[model samples]
Target chain A: MSKIKVENLTKVFGKQKKRALQLLKEGQTKKDILEKTGCTVGVNQANFTVEEGEIFVIMGLSGSGKSTLVRMLNRLIDPTSGSVFIDSEDISKVNDDQLRQIRRKTISMVFQRFALFPHRTVLENTAYGLEVQGIPKNKREDRAMETLQMVGLKGYEHQLPSQLSGGMQQRVGLARALTNDPDILLMDEAFSALDPLIRKDMQDELIELQSAMQKTIVFITHDLDEALRIGDRIALMKDGVIVQIGTPEEILTDPANEYVERFVEDVDWSKVLQAENVMKRAEMITLDKDGPRVALNRMRETGLSSLFAVDRRNRLQGVLSADAAKQAIDEGKPLADLIERDIVKVRPDTLLNDIMVQMAETNHPVAVVSDDDRVRGVIVRGSVIGALTGKEVKTHD
Target chain B: MTESIPKLPLADVVEVIVSWLQANVGWLFDFISNLIEPTVAFFTAVLMFLPTLVTIVLIAALTWWLSSWRIALFTLIGLMLIANLGYWEESAQTTALVLTATVISIIIGVPIGILCGKNDTARNIITPILDFMQTMPAFVYLVPAVIFFSLGTVPGVIASVVFSMPPTIRLTNLGIRQVPEDLIEASDAFGSTSSQKLFKIQLPLAKTTIMAGINQTIMLALSMVVIASMIGARGLGEAVLTAVQRIEVGTGFEAGLAIVIIAIVLDRLTQNLGQGNGQHPRN
Candidate 1:
């Protein structure tokens, strides 16, 4: 089962909820429904499932219901209709006590404004969730200390939140959520309030933390770039409805609608598109099986100066240049002797921006390798430049 | 003959209501008075029992602890002046009365303020009542105080509480309402119960504002001392009243000066306490 499954979740903020829901069922726009019923649609028919340990991002412009949708996941904002199933239990149907248990034991949240209690010490703020759980003081503090240390706030425990800088205060907020050790983290615009540099640092920190902790995070943001950088799957919200849900590559390459297209149009493609998206199938030869003559023929046919030489298992051995191939064929040497091992190799997930750098520093195309060192594909310098310039590059299985 | 304009009988309406309350709910007033009497008496007796020199020294030390030495020195010199002028005992009695009234007002005001703060309907209902309590003349409360508790320190304490309580209520409500929405959400997001949120997050963050409210309450109670004296409550107010009745300029000046000195000391101490620092200046 998915870690969280939300189906037809909706929220209407005002008294005329019945009318609003009717209009919603009739497929009225948010503005038309508001004009007709005087009830604002906060979220409309939001349906998605968050996989375990996935960083699922909900992104939108302000008032697009992204924040409202996340709040519904934890039942902080009750849904007007439909349900959210966490671990196969519909949280919308849970009682107050059960909801609180869900919040305490299953889900914890980091807020946009770094909502640390100003009167509380850093340690006390970090321990707030554990304290709410009725844990003993010493035990809670010990756990809070460890969480604080994990967030890189070791020696600053006794200081009040007001005494700390904005970034440090946000770390305390993060530590507060982490101390609960919950399965799902609902971060509502968690880094939007920080300085640009600090925001980037915090995003990096969250990514690093997620890799280590493997917590399912449903992060909310209005920033497409942030979503692209950190999200495993992104749900793009617009006008109280989720317009699209896809991976960053899919969102960038094939938007679900015009709104999604325009939303992603301004994103730097070099950063968003990885080697997997830009790579083309390159003609290659197995070093153990293919002779230099075969390598030369393949290179000539592909109209390339070199070909990647791999083992029978497709593990990359090295590159075979046209000169080396011809020299090997004349000297009757093995293809292994002619192979050059100095070429750059990248993983499929390595960003095109980094691949561009590699392309700039080398004359040969970079080889895309799998974790097992098998050659997946090759990214030519032309492909990197073409992808950045918005030309479609052929991708293969 | 020109048509005469009809007069509105607001005063008669109030008089009838007061009479009805006096007749029907007199026992309730007696019960409240019974509760308040001992508290006022105990505080009064303690303040009067402490030797004037000891009281002065202790107050000066407390002021020094809570605020700057300048204010402390000011308090020391001010208390000595009152003692030299032979009004120290009366000043102490007035201080006791203000303390009693402030404590009672806080007891009545804070929870009501919290209710108003938490619920919009409660706030809408209580706001007009608070306006009435605040805007009504101080002397108007005395008429009901006398009818309920009769002429003495108890009636004076009751009147002072009624007059001074509004600021505490209004400000406490404002303070709690002013607690940032995000912080309240954070508390809720952490699964805090309603009472836990109030105590742990709301109250602590609202401390400065609530303390400001208490400071206003005490100051308002102090302002009521002389007015309360007309209903037979004793203190520096009595001395001032006596001076006024006898037309003694020297006595009135001394008593007035003593009241001013007490007001300054109370104001500085409470203001400093409201700032949430009793030890030293904030960096």
Candidate 2:
């Protein structure tokens, strides 16, 4: 079930009469005036359903409204229009007092700036949301301590926000957002402000936290790589509109438009796209009784240089490269004896990014697919490349 | 022999310093006043050129615009009514006196503010004095003015100036101190001179806070107008005092309402002018 849902949200600023008067007085051109007074359409027709325990990421550049969209989920900023449902209840129209109750108990947010009250110590800042919910001070402190320990900030709870490094401050922000035991956590570029090394550490820390307590998270960032690293599903935003939403592998392999393609263009596909996407289906290829020669020729026809040499029932076959087969045939060796065994393999479920890494490291062009040592199919560099570049692949979903 | 030779008492050294200060006091005050007098005189003259009726209406309209139009309309109506009710001349006199006093206070107070902002020692030394100046009753300041300058507009001006000056100085110092360190560093990196840094960056950043202080100073000066009338300064304060003495309820009420109108107007105009230039002055 979806934990949070947002639909068609919008926000426009400077609607007051004085602002209108000022605009008229300034003698601004219609275009400039319109730009200044225009409706931001902050979350234009935004619609999303985040499942329970999902780490859904909203990725966008600055001013693309990802932060604004996340802020609406917790009612930090009211939407100009649209509805938000948290746990099946519409919270868009909730009054300030009721919203406060919802925020205190149902959803918590960590700001990119780590908006920990500068005057407060780490422990106090973490405990604030709980205190607002009327939790006893001592109990809240204890809970805050537990959260601090969870975020690896156990030794530094007494320090001020200014006293901590950027990473530590963000951990404090994370701890504070989580201390209330809310069902949903909204992180608005929570680690983007930190140093690169520190950002990675915080991402790993968040993964560890989510593994133990799988509250739904809507994290926002401008970094596509970070989104892919952390997100269970990602919503890519452009100009206040959601361009696409899906798993990292889906986005990497099947971008919706040229905009998304431009974003992913410089990405190292060998490290990002997985081998499972390119893995051939065993039933799709015909097995020849003529053995390896026939299979190699069929691979060349299929634009693959290698084939999986299988038995009559299609079980326990090894890879047959055309070059290897030809060399063995010329050397007067039996085709079955010459066929190389112990080829690299991939499960259909392995992420494309992981498979690409393995392929690059091992310099393997073709990987064998098997079901318990029974040959499934041969996945070659060309097939995977086509899949990575968003070409249509004839494969089962 | 060294132990037997006792040091001269500290009082002897203090006495000599006091004598020297007394001799130089007139020269010091003259030189400082000469340095400040032209700026103060310039604004004061410009302010006086504004016709009394226009000043009242302009100030009221400005205050209303910055705060709320509703408040502005009420203030404008109030000022006109106060004039029609025969308190117009007195209200004008009070407006003139308060504006003059506030302007003078800013001139003198801003320099002290700069000093306090630039020097840690000055800030530390002057902070307690500022606290005392802010907290002490406006009436207490009159006691010193009465003893030194005697009674009337001049003495009342002196007393009102002391009461109103602290906020400007304190706020200016605070505003300067609050300027972002990164911005200051960037200025330095660009090879900006001290004066350039002060004028271009620090002062501009502190403008909002300084304006707020000026607003507070004006309000304080307005409040003192009625009290200063007890010593013989004329205006709305005198009208209110006379009405009170003679038990003229209508007169007193009109005069009191006039002060409120004037307060609203002055408050708004300063606020708008300070906040208007398309930059949010960080308070």
Native contacts present in each candidate (fraction):
0.70, 0.00
lDDT of 2 at A283: 28
Worst 10-residue lDDT window, candidate 2 chain A: A282-291
How good is model 1 by TM-score? 0.95
User: Lowest-scoring 10 consecutive residues by lDDT in candidate 1 chain A?
Assistant: A388-397
lDDT tens digits, residue span A181-211, model 2: 8888888888989999989888888998899
Report per-candidate DockQ. 0.63, 0.02
Tell me the docking grade of candidate 2. incorrect
Quick one: best lDDT, which candidate? 1
In angstroms, give how far residue A149 of model 2 lies from its true place. Answer: 2.0
Predictions: Cα RMSD each = 2.4, 23.1
Give me the runs in candidate 1 sitting further than 4 Å from their true place.
A288-290, A311-313, A329-335, A394-397, B1-24, B278-283
